[model samples]
Target: MHPLISAADLRAWLARRPETVLLDCSFDLADPSAGERAYAEAHLPGARYAHLDRDLSAPKTGRNGRHPLRDRPAYAAWMGRMGVAPGVPVIAYDRQGGMFAVRAWWVLRWMGHADVALLDGGLPAWQAEGNAVTADVPAERPAPAYPDLPPAMPRIDAAQLQPRLGEVQMLDARAPERYRGEVEPLDPVAGHIPGALNRFFKDNLQPDGRFKPAEQLKREFEALIDTERPVVHMCGSGVTACHNLLAMEVAGLGRSRLYPGSWSEWCSDPSRPVAKGAAA
Candidate 1:
């Protein structure tokens, strides 16, 4: 089982295990530089910053979403630079409830690395409990070789997605207002993909802003897709959508492919079709 570590559990692991790799993935879509500045000011001891814009995503393709997935080989090479070798246990965290950190988690899973987990409640929770913090930069790693990634990553274009509509399960992790086109906070178009199910990523959180347990998460996801059909996960910019992907994994619903462009890229062109309101 993939270990889900609470703050206390992490503290325990820190004391006994030297193999723990803590990654700081704090990010801000509005102010991109804020995350790095914050990490430099004060971060968990031995934590390394993983920039969402640079380290995790690819260059913007005007038509593609704001943050598209980098090529698997490129990403694998980047991971090697970050000192992540095969079979290492990784712990990712962010200021919010594992929001951005989950992206790191999802990408690692896509690469078939299973010994990874998100820090519950993220930095705020860690600080609330008086965990240690430092401004020291982590040591760089010697370049190591990485295995070749799979060529075919399961993903769908908007045109291709239209035909698969109800046949395969599609999930939208955006807010209800955005899903309904009531008000769009980030995109040019303010609606969701037709036939996409709405399950705001925040819904996966508990009252404490931490993710709910696997049992509850399983119930929520099973309502949409059985384990049989492959699930396609999407969101406004394909960032927070990772929250759903991570939750589903914790829920034991298995892995799902991400629509990296999500609503942002989906609505970039006037020619692409747009759907409003809940899925019919």
Candidate 2:
């Protein structure tokens, strides 16, 4: 299956395999609890709520950025508990135009699961297709255990990315203002990594909340960053960066590495250089 699944296709999949794991990854960075509360009100039938701060992220230690990854074994255990064993189709969706769903997709892939995909347009599209949502949550069945394998997703950290600054194509997924040091509501530092280009994660979506065509995404990405150099994606605390990576896969650009620590980690270190203003 493709990285993105249409609402119609998702319904079809559910009909054939009722045991498929459908995850609702709705989140609000500010309130944090808002997502789960909303999930309780209504969600796709059989959808399990994946909390952003609780399920998908590691506890922050001030230095590792706001939302570092949970250890591999710990993450695998969570997946096992959620019934996401090998070959189980996992469909992640979010209310925010897949803003949080992509994170689920990325993390699941990082955990060595290849059957994960996002509900292309997320909750809005699911409802728009006349699919009924339910307030009742499904009980998570324990999945069979599997051997721990090396992580599949590639990553870069501050220590590894600093020296290669201009040599690597760093793409900052934050909004233009956040990237430009004009306004920074999150991270303490109000700038981006030097030589990093700004391409707001939202730009990857069409006006209707669905992702743009794969060809359109390919053109936009090719025009933004040099294809010759290595590409590493980042956002305020590394959460939104996965959206771009997912977009690239949809564009068939192959996988790229993610700077999981991202800007939050970069700015935490007083020694790292911070670039302000727009892209030069």
TM-score for each model = 0.91, 0.98
lDDT of 1 by residue, 1-280 (tens): 2635788788877787656678899988889999999999988888889999998889987787888888788778877777777766788999878878987887776776666788888887788788889999989873464566443225666677767776877789888888989998777788887778898999999978778989999998887667678988899878788888878878887777788789989888887678897777
Per-model tally of clashing residue pairs:
0, 0
Give the poorly placed runs of model 1, Cα more than 4 Å off.
1-3, 149-154, 224-228
Best by TM-score: 2
Alpha-carbon runs more than 4 Å astray in model 2: 144-146
lDDT of 1 at 202: 95
Which digits, one per residue and each the tens of the lDDT, describe model 2 over residues 1-280?
5799999999998999998999999999989999999999999999999998899999988899988988888888889888998888999999998999888899988888888899989999999999999999898697754348667789988899999987899889999999999998877878999999998999999887999999999999999987656789999988899999999989988889999989888899899999999888
Residue pairs in clash, model 1: none
Q: Tell me which residue pairs clash in candidate 2.
A: none
RMSD of each: 2.2, 1.0
Clashes of 1: 0
Best candidate according to lDDT: 2
